[model samples]
Target: MRMGFTGMTLDRADHLRRDEQALKLARMHPSARFLLLDGLKPVLAPDADRLLWVRRSQAPDNPSIFLGLDEEGIPHFALAGAAADVGGIATDARAAGTRLSAPEAGIVALARSLLDWHDRHGFCAACGAPTRPVKGGYGRQCDRCTAQHFPRVDPVVIMLAEKDGLALVGRQPGFPAGFFSALAGFVEPGESLEEAVARELWEEAGVRARSVRYVASQPWPFPSSLMIGALATADSHALSPDFEELEEARWVSREECAAALRGDGDWSAPPPLAIAHWLLRAWVEGQVPPS
Candidate 1:
């Protein structure tokens, strides 16, 4: 199952950074566009299809982050400003569905992540001095220490544990009854993807995974995170919930998992855009080892 926000819309022209003429053309070109990003939300214009795109002057006066060039060779930028600055609707990036083109949606995610990084990193991490954006919003330079800082993406491991033709899915305390998805946790320092998968499964559900395999990955830019999807063979099926991360876990058959994915079963599952849905479907389709 292909997921949204997987495609790259911009060419990310790094060579033009030091080229004044090329940079000016990219900024002053009539074909260039700037998307307004307020914090993590994007300014969107509602259409009959509800696609999210708002046109502004080629050169915006506000401090803008230079996004990459589109396939047509048009430069794109993102400006962090108020929603009222434009007549369009300011909405969350998640609303970009069929209403918005896939490339546009992917760009929105990139804009949100970049703008959010700049928002929270106004000060130097090394010295306490104030920092200014450089490299077209890619990094910040500290005035006092002259240190350069770049944005970061957090990695999270979301996995499905399968054993004896059954999948282990669990939910937290506040989830709707019978609503369960893949177990996930942030990757700690010095931890590998397979190690994080096994550790998270054990800590959340008390399930020990003997072997883990890489499945797929997705960029979940809700404040910037890379979701690493994995599948593992369960070594034990002891029922124990951490109560903080999960309440209880159950082993559901592949047939029941299929019904849940179709939204016709007793329980509900994650949506197609979420990597968890793909991981579950892969297990049901026998793409993962089921011992």
Candidate 2:
């Protein structure tokens, strides 16, 4: 039951990563696998369905990110920047899920997040000095002021609020028509996950959640976010969506949600790769409390 990007079995031994020579050895591993990103898009094999993992000799001089080692101690790496016309293969990161294996999907997510982090955080915030990758891509070090920085991961609360036999779903204004998903919002400063879930439900759909429970988490790498999946029991079953953020918000029955997840219903739920779809599936399958 591993989610798309949750089962990355690689050992990211960050504590033991000070040896730069070890990183060099990993890069030069005879059996090392490498993936390249042209900007944020992954370069794919021309005639294959998966990422084109090139050899050490074939990889670019500098990879934008370093993915840690697998169980076999074989290292994985990624090059970010522009898609090189390497062996006539290329594909956008968004399409990686459809063609790549689940583990590779996790690797792609890591690469994408690191790419966005490096792109946005080229300068240190503490002293506004230029920073370079250090500790095998685990973080950045500013040459001036000697400030160290780690990558940023934004926490987002995504929830399914249910009452009676129905769960609430909301559609953003710009989503494909009829498409709806669990209510989600970025956690504001100084808010707990439960508080964020409650606040988002209230702000977006005017639903007051009396209680909420954690479900799971997923790495949403479209510019780097960690989706905290949750389930909430509403204080009342009511609907008054804030039009600014939602085109429509309403309670959908369990049967309807079940069909939506299966792609058989007219309503469009989030895709299978998204955590929202799993949240909806959990609700329709009676995993929520008060059963």
Candidate 3:
């Protein structure tokens, strides 16, 4: 099966060896490279002179640090004061002047979230103690509590619900006109991926689903989230959209969905980079059509 969007598989191999090497490099070198991301988009050609270096509020003894990822999949470590501030990078991306490649954007998302986590998680959750970076910046160690805290990637479920020849699509109030997408939400605590999928559908669009099947997943490090793709069979299509979550919800026929995916219809869907676009395309290609 061909993976959608950039057609790049950020698989196991890409992250395996680089993580350890990155941590070691960070420890040995006092200066490192950093990338910034705004949402899924990355800010390229950042002005290194304007980076922000945050010190640990709790650990007065811990050195201030800089954020950066290495070419070998490792993140760089350095003491603070080497770079300027963080706003310039984000501002650059927003101004439409910077252009970033697909993989580069993905890596930037990874670096931004991981570094942000390191900055915020200077304290151990297990006990009221300060934590130090370990495992090449992948984890932290709490000296007082002897606990290890790893970076976290929250999982979100994004699904396309189908019934008969139509697929369910919805729109939140603030979405651009003529735009609709698969319903989605963060997986809550103590819920399996399947349960989260079903719940989000019902909560957002008032649609109950069955036969929830895992389709694909994407690393959405807008702030460290994993988007889990799924296809579900709608038990009923009576869409009473929850006004709080969704402004409108409805079923579109396969033909209509196909046109939306192709960007030739009255309505335009999300771009190919988003998982919602892939889910809609999967329906049009009959890869995940209604049973």
Candidate 4:
């Protein structure tokens, strides 16, 4: 499957070394440079502003976090505090019609997730004491118990189920009218990717699936989630959507999916930036099973 526009490919050849060196450098220099992220968007420090400064309340440890580098090898940093608010910044960016490149979007997602994690994990669960930033903001150290905490990325399973000549699609309650995509859910603690796919399919659409195969994965940093894509086989053609989870569900034909992709149908497919769009495209192109 093809990656979405916002997908990022950063060459972190020297990042590991840089992260190790930054700590010693930060302690020596009291006023060190920091990057600011308004959600997943980076706050660029140009000529006038050499260092990004954000409100202390937003990101208390702004100077300490490690914002990953871009494809151009520029290190981006997360601005703590109100700068982490995504919806507000996204609306502003949209209103200004500030078009973002794929790499820029990826940076924004990364920044937002990193800062959010720090905000929520100010105290250690092991000792209930204040924690300090460590490892270029990748980890935290508990003052009371010496417990270490690391940033977490939740895994989500998104799959396209097919059998015969029809593919399964479903619409969640909050989706735009007539919008339907592949079924997806978070992976439980003990479940493998395939098990998660099978479980989600049966729970949401009442379909039993077999031959679950892994596809491409995407870093969906809506608070840090890794989208695991897969293709599954459904043994039945029945439409039994669990209304509690989905507003509607059906078995759509490959031609119908193709029409939706082409914007020639009553229902439209997801935007190109979403993994769902790629999954459907792969199915329509016969890269996956026809159904």
Error (Å) of candidate 2 at residue 39 is: 1.5
lDDT of candidate 1 at residue 241, scale 0 to 100: 77
Q: Which stretches of candidate 2 lie over 4 Å from their true place?
A: 81-84, 289-291
- Tens digits of per-residue lDDT for model 3, 1-291: 222222222332324324666444444543434333333233333554222322232112334233344446443333322222333344332222123445444444455566667778988887878888765466788989688888898999999988877889988899999899989999999999989989999888888888899887877645678889999998987887889998888889988888887889878788766788888888788786344
Prediction 1 TM-score vs. true: 0.92
- TM-score: the better of candidates 1 and 4: 1
- The order by descending lDDT is 2, 1, 4, 3
Off by over 4 Å in 1: 17-21, 48-60, 97-99, 289-291
Error of 2 at 19 (Å): 1.6
Error of 4 at 77 (Å): 2.2
Q: Candidate 3: misplaced stretches above 4 Å? A: 1-43, 46-99, 289-291
Stretches off by above 4 angstroms in model 4 are: 5-21, 24-35, 39-61, 68-74, 81-98, 289-291
**Window of ten residues with lowest summed lDDT in model 3:** 51-60
Leading candidate by lDDT: 2
- Tens digits of per-residue lDDT for model 1 on 174-242? 888878898999999999999999999888888889678888888888889999988889987676879
Separately for all candidates shown, the number of backbone clashes (residues 3 or more apart, or on different chains) is 1, 3, 9, 9
